[model samples]
Target: MNGHSGNVFVLSAPSGTGKSTLAKRLVKDVPDLDFSISFTTRAPRAGETDGKDYFFVDDATFDRMIRTGGLVEWVEVYGHKYGTGKEWVSAHLAAGKDILLDIETQGARNVHGTLPDAVMIFLIPPSAEELSNRLRSRGRDPEAEIQVRLDYAKHELCEYPAYDYLVVNDTLDRAYRDLESIVLATRLRRERMGDTAQRILEGF
Candidate 1:
């Protein structure tokens, strides 16, 4: 690990945990933060651009990327294949941009397995009841599916300790600040700070 090495941050959470909302807020608060646009087989949501929210591709194209090793990590979720492209992340990292990846727990695990030095954060809801409420509030998914998701969220929360940091999303503003602090602190690490690392060592 070196100061100049690009950082890869893996953010994981269950559906309705407010990971997306918190991530958006974090980027708005952090000037230099870059959100890695993921590749997906799912259709774009309303107002989401092709390259901005996700790289929309067919299943065959996604499979090709998988075979050709174009993705850093990929996973199938909710019947769609989603992945982060390696080139895009490497380019941003090489340019010294702090990148944040909003992904599912399985995808986060895959990224961690490959990029062990990367920082991993898990966002948690206040409770299972709150998670269900949030999901229901969205007005999506059938009752059966919502129940399924609630069950899945419970299982996902059990992996909290595997992450470098646990951010409870009771309040978006507070969670954003906590996540920003984590990124700033990580950037100050000796391995990532280079000359600053030497200066700190000298002072010590």
Candidate 2:
């Protein structure tokens, strides 16, 4: 049951679903929560710092990690590669720090395979039309790329049933509150509070 460790919260959503924004805000506003910065081969976008937003690397470095198994899971998307570090996740979880992992749906499933107790949260927009509108409003991708993302979102939304929680991002503030409540509820679960509960019983 991974007693005395920390909870791994896997947050996943389609591109332009505002998952990144929600993750950043949750880590910023919440206490004792760490963001698992992913490694990517993609070039830095505007205002994206090297170590903060992502650890930008070349294809060779990314391949090395894959070959050496330094990454827990990796995937290629839109011609760029992304991966999560194995050591970082292990060390943080051992230290009892709840970490938020923002990855794709497939990666989340892979993580669940190993960490069966990990909390999986799938975020979605109100509707498919709204998802397309959000993707188009970003202005980051062209018409074809946007269409590709929309098509993927439709497919990804179907996988939400596999997740532990489904959050509809109708409004940012409301969604944030939902995330906070989930964290609190998970923390207070009897399995996670084994030590604390035992101590209280001993006192009685």
Candidate 3:
């Protein structure tokens, strides 16, 4: 709809659903797939870089961005702030590189509202029990937080109908194939490739 050369792909799922794992592999396997590293108020973990994994800003700076309308879409999760900077993503698209946004369901909705043409895909675990097990096995959060995530997962699943594509990650290999196919299909979309088509047709 925007006639821009690059596409915005929003991949969202509940915690512990293997979205990040698959996303890492997808970006490597697909050419020209750039990731929009989010800005976070939370402290960086071990070996995390400032501009790579996240912008790593403090709460005050994050609030200032929100107030100034610097972020394309920002959301607070588990008491921490996360956002995608408007200039960062817009510049990437202007340079003709697609960007993949790994965000939460609520953030995805906000992005969709702003960029109505953005493609959205929802990743789902094989089952709810499996999702719960994955979260518990991580042993990162306390029992109360884990339970809260599990409850949130159930609600997140309900938003599946909103996405353009539903990918059930039952196996890594199969899911990767599906993800690649989606990327390829989106890239080949006639609307996204009108210039290429005109060149080929006119033999210029």
Candidate 4:
């Protein structure tokens, strides 16, 4: 439907589900894929860069961007606001660059509404116990906060039906392969191959 414009790949998963790790790997391993760095109102963790990890901003700046219609999609997660910039995503996509959006389920749904053709993938843990173990292993949050995240994970899992693909991250290698296949398959879809199809037809 977007013709030759780039495709948007939206990846969403519950906290501690390895979504971020997979996204980083996908961009590193795949060709011509760009990761969309979102803006966040939360303080940066140690070793996190301002623009590389996220565009860390104050509440006022984030509110201003919201008022000026600069955000493509935004959501409040764990008391902090995170949003994707409208201009940046539009410019890169129009240049025919595939972009990966690592966002929450709500933001993914919002992006889907805005860009109907965007590919949405939901990552699932092998089991609830595994998810809880993963959260505890992080050692980043307090016990209570970790419980909150696990509770939220249950609700998030319910939204998997809405996603285009469900990737079970039981094993990292297998999950990465699945994610990679989805990216490749989307690029070969009929609508995205219009220009290539024309060139081939012309040769005949």
Candidate 5:
């Protein structure tokens, strides 16, 4: 076993809160941090690569993975299944590489149960009105679907208190900075820095 394990950072937010964009940016800015690519039983959309965006699998394959314990957490959303691979996460953490999981609230909670050391951050819009506007701007969902998402967003907001940090994503640049800061701060925690501290003390 490795002497050290890296941190798992979970980012959760409502559908229209820009959490995905922020997560991508944070991974690009942070060194040695990788974004966890999820496996989904949904078809790839335009411009989305098979491995980059998600590992697209069929229902049978997804079910087989679940039965064999290959997935860490699996959830069905809008009739499609999405899950994180257990082996991939374990290997990275064992190698002392931090990982970023941009999943929904339920997935975050599930990961926390297994990896209790994970740092969960909740992102929210500046105002409910802004959230609604952002959702509408996507132009992909129908009116009814949009309403469903907005209602779900309200419920998601109530879970913010359970997160380690809450970031308001009113401005992209500011939100990215805040997210980056949280990752850096977690890395500098005493528990994570124990080996480095020991090495420094030995030199003195």
Candidate 6:
């Protein structure tokens, strides 16, 4: 990791909140917005491609990554591990690229601690009932596992105060609009746009 700029945008949500879908669409539509594909200890779900959806690894490899400082932020959820790699993010940011992290609440906190300039957003479902319904629609987790996720969500929701923005994923398109607005707005801040403004001022 070299001189990192810490121009990171982090999105955190409980399971079934549509965070992953939004993050993907945001990256695709936004210029200079790179998706930070995370490392995970969980087995790949149906339709999840390795190195695309996630870098799935075993426990030993994950532990070694933790020990060697390879991860920027990592956390254990539902007995599985998830992490963002340090080198990838630092390299991108150092090269003047913006990165979007789709992560859990704990990992978001950790990233904020490291990159104080990073923007944090929390995405939530419209209601607990809807949250449960979305999980069911995925058909990835069994009934008991869904219940476990819901219970964890109850605890995770308490961390909303830590986020800079809150997006309720009631409608996919509308939520994306709000998310896009936040990112675009952040880019216009003086800290980010100062160089461009300075050059224009000098020309004048």
* lDDT scores of the candidates, listed in order: 0.86, 0.89, 0.89, 0.93, 0.89, 0.90
- Candidate 6 C-alpha RMSD relative to the actual structure: 2.5
Over the stretch 99-160, how does candidate 4's per-residue lDDT look in tens digits? 99998998888887677889999999999999999999999999999999999999899999
Ranking by TM-score: 4, 5, 2, 6, 3, 1
Q: Judging by lDDT against the true structure, name the best candidate.
A: 4
Specify the poorest-scoring 10-residue window by lDDT in model 4.
1-10
Candidate with top TM-score is 4
lDDT of 5 by residue, 20-40 (tens): 888888888889999999999
Can you list the residue pairs that collide in candidate 2?
none
Clashing pairs in 1: 3-191, 3-192
Question: Clashing pairs in model 5?
Answer: none
State the lDDT at 48 in candidate 1.
88
* Clash count of each predicted structure: 2, 0, 0, 0, 0, 0
Q: Which stretches of candidate 6 lie over 4 Å from their true place?
A: 1-6
RMSD of 2: 1.8
For model 2, the local distance difference test gives 0.89
Model 3 clash pairs?
none
Encode model 6's per-residue lDDT on 1-204: one tens digit a residue.
122353689999998899888999999999888999999999998889999999999999999999999998999987899999999998889887889998899898898777788899999999999999999998888999999999999888999999999999999999999999998898777777777777799998
Tens digits of per-residue lDDT for model 1 on 130-181?
8899999999789999999998898888888789999888877787888888
TM-scores, all models, native as reference: 0.91, 0.95, 0.93, 0.96, 0.95, 0.94
TM-score, cand. 3 vs. native: 0.93
Q: After superposition, how far is residue 55 of candidate 1 from its true place, in Å?
A: 0.8
Per-residue lDDT of model 3, residues 140-180, tens digit only: 88999998998999999999988999999888899889888
Candidate 2, superposed: residue stretches over 4 Å from native: 1-3
